[model samples]
Target chain A: MPFHPACHSYEPVTIADRLFLDLRRAILEGELPAGKKISEPELASIYGVSRGSLREAISKLENCNLVTRRPNIGARIVNFSIDQLMEIYQIREAMEGMAARLAAKNMTEAELAHLKSLVARHKDSLLHTERPAKTDYSQDADVDFHFCIIQGSKNQRLLTMLCQDLYDLVRFYRMRLSPAFSSTAMQEHELIVQALERRDGEMAELLMRYHVRASRDRAKQRLESMSPEELGSHH
Target chain B: MPFHPACHSYEPVTIADRLFLDLRRAILEGELPAGKKISEPELASIYGVSRGSLREAISKLENCNLVTRRPNIGARIVNFSIDQLMEIYQIREAMEGMAARLAAKNMTEAELAHLKSLVARHKDSLLHTERPAKTDYSQDADVDFHFCIIQGSKNQRLLTMLCQDLYDLVRFYRMRLSPAFSSTAMQEHELIVQALERRDGEMAELLMRYHVRASRDRAKQRLESMSPEELGSHH
Candidate 1:
């Protein structure tokens, strides 16, 4: 049937969907560790939902690769192998590069101004203290900067696909931003902004690719220092 | 839950899965056009499967975005808006470009040999056939060449994500190839192969991006000449 916008627009939120969203948030925030089994009955009771609703939520999670489901077995949180991580980064590098290129050509004046403000705010935050007690604001600003560029691309399909793949990994990337790294990222963002200002699509794309690769390198270095068990820990 | 290898190494195929695969193939092949509502009871009876099995299959299809499901309503194949089509091509250009670059660095000798053979076969087919007939084989060869590059990238995540997005539209692209266009595509593929052979990653990536943009331009030209209804007919 056609999506009957009326039905989708005002219908009361379903228990299954609510559960799915909550579970997804937990996974993305690293509250649900990798390799942990998620029991349906346990979740159903905790969420005050029926087993059927819980199963539906689990199915959606499985589709997102946030959870794995085996017939006659049970669900567990997903863990990426080294190869999978590498593959994910490779895809991200290309998609983000494209986003930067398009943003260079298509960003509206208002959007470009907003991006500049975001970068300025981040720079101010870095100067305020050697290390802030709360990194959430800075992180949010960082996300906004990237999100603006992706949205400025005016490519909703690419944005949707990349967001789905990258959401759960955002925290991992965020944790790698040390004071020194944050300074470097700020400088990189300035170059990206300059390229966008000049409408230099190729330079913008190259810079964005380099930024992502640099982040990936930092993440890899961090992972290399951790024990296997520590690396497997979600938080 | 991790994927469990089936006991006994093999088991009788389930009717539900068979129906699901058949339906998926039909959708991908454009036999079941986008925006067509799927009747569950009718499909169940036609496929000789239970209604429950049909529902399960529909759920999987919905996840793939091949079909859209509304609560308490039903499912229909998804149709892309013009904006969505443009966005899709933008993502494809980036992904195919990255795949070409990685393929240049990573293609095995055996895979390169296989790609050469495909090109040779298409050339042989061209020598004996008329314009349109020759074009058909040549387009098939183009698809195979791109597929080989994606495979050679050794990035499963990139391949899987791109496969999901491009599976249906590739048919539209294939249908638009003309004999003249095919010859040009062959020459482009030859240049891509030469870049790969020389391990010139930047050249390979640049050529692939240009090739995709050229294809997109052709698609846009064809789309401009056609009415909305005619475009819908292709789906």
Candidate 2:
């Protein structure tokens, strides 16, 4: 099977892989809570696993950038800040922009058609929803849109870097910033799809970069408007 | 101290970290050889460390993209491939392009001066060397030049992604493809430096992307000219 550019698609095969997925979900969903120190023994006992399995799981988490491990200090969940979020967007703007460009040149006609249908479905859903911003579906569909383009790039290294290493962090932030979707963002997605349909790599990259940068600015505005307590509160 | 965008700058503080560093050097220097299956028992005995420490070190290598671990097949050193090298260059073109743009706006005056001096030194070294292409000094200087700009971008996450995650693979390729340097690459560096000096982020990004793309083309040409045996040899 071709690799998909979303962490949710990863199938866990081993004990450590299962545990990593569970802990990853917990962190992204805010169930474990951000910036919390990991207690290896406590977690192992709670999960009815050995320390070795838990350590292995935590190492996987660290690879995903969901957990930070220091030499002397133990692992801590990644803390959120607007600055860090902006930094992430900066990366997305570059990497995803490249992905879009590659996809334009490389995506099969069937893939492009699939992408168009996906965007159309998203638009339909947004139009039908009573409160599109309040629904989690919009957020998920947004992720799917980005994932399709990234996977279409046909660059395995770029796919692994974005999907496995970075998208978990993206989900972590998106969970906190629920209701981040907007009609403007949808419009941007439509434009990107159009560029891809035309097979204009340059235009596709430009649109993707613009879309990511606009999202960053919107996220910054939303984050700035929130009080510290509001921003800190786990959803 | 600021985090430098080079893995060699990392200080190994723990046993596992030390092992990781040692093993990383082994892989990049081709002492371990490319595409070799890692034997935990053998490696642990050779390093005089426990299997657990060796496993930890291997895990670190996986994160650096130097090793690939399959569920049931075990870990193997990443095999060299022209296609994979091209993929990496595409990523670098996007990311390092963004780095140049950010550095133009974010780099301090001192950093700019330091960069200017770095280019001057590299140029001087190139002029004085009898066979500049064969010397490792040029490669190191080339790495340093890119590192300076990536560090100057002042994006901590970008620094980590490039330095910790991607550059090792870059070094792996460079080790096999040494004598890849040319005066053209240096001239490209000079243009990027000038753009940064003028604080022109757009121009800096344009020049940086062009440089990476050109380097990719050059590497492709050199690889094509080599015999399959020559390309596969672990230099």
Candidate 3:
């Protein structure tokens, strides 16, 4: 029998698939630090892959906005300036606002319950840490909370755009976010969850938008406070 | 002197750049109809390009969701089902909604006046067309209207995502939009402009979101009314 590819199902993975994820993770975690010049030969050898495989990965990363390549010159990791990061936050406000609205109607009772618990846990942590700025919560946990709400939106396209397309860039931003940013974020999350429980989609969406904008302001202020000398591209 | 790549500016373009735009135009215009299998060799021959160049173009197209490649399975033009189209509308709602909000705040007096004339011209055409449904106004004008508002948002990242990344797909949807959809859209555009004139960002955003969602419903209802026997994959 002839093997016909399924209309909706994806085919098997290739080197480009794996390398794209690996390179993306490295960049997000600052392993391949921003503003660093990427030597294709070095990466190909380091990853134990061919130049062809590495180039493909580079192309995919470029598409994902994680890396940028110049003709004749070469590729470099994307360096987000303070302004660019704030622009990202503005986009996030719109995206997550819609996500919260959808989640209000789509989230299951059990999902709502888990979200409640997640916020409560964060609130407890906020209370316990006398100097909340000194206690660094797991970035993954923070990621999970936002991701959970996004998943609850049940919009596959939205999921792909947010959780997949913008994943690395958002991760990079959140990873560098100061611990002091958490308490307010936690409070906002609690209110968002409460609105979701009541199926108040409008309120939930508005609050989520406000939450993201507030976070952006905090991030911008923090970055601004850093003396120009210390806010180097590599760091 | 150290050769440093600019963080915000993109690097130079190559063959992939030209072909991606060419092929995208062909696809959105339905010259490369939806559900058509993409043969690299055929496309290469058609465009007088090498296989290597063609593949790069294909990769770019896939990234834009204009085409879908399934590893071992081949690539095909993205064939949107009604549900998928609705999903696209939801995403557009969020993005254009944010865009309208920002545009309301940022558009200069001259920009707002130009926008006024644009909608006025469309209204004139709409009134003149005999059946209106048969005349088919230029899709480029429609694109410019949205692109203008998106530009007014003045958010580079949002601009890239809307204009650069999701561009072709959005164009495809707009190109297929029935002319019957024009009258109401024109009227709504007028209202949105009025809101912008008043500098009511919130109302402008809401109207824009509603406009997009209303368009989606009309498209959905039209598609649904067609019989399953008419539901060819190509259609």
Best of the candidates, TM-score: 2
How are the candidates ranked when ordered by TM-score, highest leading?
Answer: 2, 3, 1
Report how far off residue A210 is in candidate 2 (Å). Answer: 0.6
Of 1 and 3, the candidate ahead on DockQ is 1
Query: Tens digit of lDDT per residue, candidate 2, span A1-235?
Result: 1125243446777888889878887888789988889998899999999999888889988888999888777999998677888999999999999999999999999999999999999899878877755545888788889989998999988888998777788788877764768999999999999999899999999999999999999989988887887666532
Docking class of 2: high
Each candidate: fraction of true contacts kept?
Answer: 0.77, 0.80, 0.74
Q: In candidate 2, what are the lDDT values of residues B94-178, reduced to their tens digit?
A: 9999999999999999999999999999899878877755445788888889999998999988888998778878888888874
Sort by lDDT, best first.
2, 3, 1
TM-scores vs. true structure, each candidate: 0.86, 0.95, 0.87
Q: What are the clashing pairs of model 1?
A: A1-B75, A68-B1, A76-B1
For candidate 2, give the lDDT of residue A30. 85
lDDT of 1 by residue, A1-235 (tens): 1112221233337777777778877776567777789988887898899987787788777666678766567898886665566677788789999999999988998989988988888888888877756544666666677878988887876666666555445543344333234678788889999999998999999999998888677667766766766555543
Docking class of 1: medium
Model 3: colliding residue pairs = none
DockQ (C-alpha based) per candidate is 0.62, 0.80, 0.62
Give a tens-digit lDDT track for model 3, residues A1-235.
Answer: 1011221223327887687778877887678878788999999999899987788888888876788777668999987787777778888899989999999999999988898888777777667867655445645556667778888888877776775456567777655555564666777888888899999999999999999888788778887887865555633
> Which has the higher DockQ value, candidate number 2 or candidate number 3?
2
